[model samples]
Target: MRSIQALPEFHVFFNDHVVNNFNTLFISMPSSKEYYATGVSGSVHNRLFPKASFDFIHTSYSLQWLSKLLKELVDKQSLAWNKGKVSYPNSAKEVVEAYKMHFGKDIEWFFNARALEIVSLEILWFFLIPSVADSHCKCVIIAVFDLLGSALMELAVQGLVDEDKVDNCNLSIPDEIASLIESNNGDFI
Candidate 1:
């Protein structure tokens, strides 16, 4: 927080796909702050800034939502199609692989896009609820999603929820930080 206050001048850009809520965001910005705030409404899968324009970038709990679900999961003819579950569990190997593949592509796209926008050695802080198993693990987010999927499955069994709708939904958890490092050639830390 001190580093933020110490900066000479800075501009904070809030980017999202939704434009209607931006007016509320702009109004909430402090008028007395030393920095400026701007909103850019778009998908992060594409470039959002000019080359070497940002010194720092931060993303929190957003990258898990892929731009689209995995192709095989949506294709009716594919054997790897996710027919019943809204999200992947360890039990479903093919579904898990599909989610992982999609996540890898999404993360690669994110890093490549940011690499163009961020200056050399600049910082990129990604805050996510890691899907790691530990003694002290409290993965509430994952648990909530799992519960939701379970609920949807139950509703589908009761003929209340559409099976296709549940089958098409997925939330990816990119837990392989080392893989991301390796894929990006160690350019980002």
Candidate 2:
């Protein structure tokens, strides 16, 4: 639980889409901020830094975004075509499995890039809300996503948005990331 305060000197980097205002982020800095701040632009799935550039890396409420939408989900001919759904709560087995498979790759991209970027034997801390296998929580979450789908359907009915577009969209429900880590044959673990 030791913080950067323990270090006499440390650097902090902020990363997000290229469209984010880096000036605003730097301007809203803490009064006691002692570390250097650098803003990195682009997807985390790609390499953003040189090897051994950092000793510690951390991810917060990000990482939910897949590197890209699964081609199968977007293709009409694919069995994984998630039709008319914003979330996978009520999706078919094929659709759900497709999402899980895609997430595995997306997460691997994130980890693989970090593995190359971070210093050897250092910590790579990340945070993500994975879909729990619990029953009550599952039911509640299913209801919520179903409601969201219904809302999008209403928008489509009103002609505010294209129905086909809504059908093409799919919200992420990441499977157990711990399992992904366990299955890794890499040296990071």
Which candidate number maximizes lDDT? 2
lDDT of 1 by residue, 76-169 (tens): 7886686665555532567667767777777777888888988875588877657643323447766677788889989989999888888887
- The runs of at least 3 residues in candidate 1 whose Cα sits more than 4 Å from the true structure, single-residue gaps closed, are 1-7, 18-20, 27-35, 132-138, 157-160
What are the Cα lDDT values of the candidates? 0.74, 0.78
Clashing pairs in 2: none
Error of 2 at 120 (Å): 3.1
Off by over 4 Å in 2: 1-7, 27-35, 134-143, 185-189
Q: Clashes in model 1: which pairs?
A: none
lDDT of 2 at 69: 78
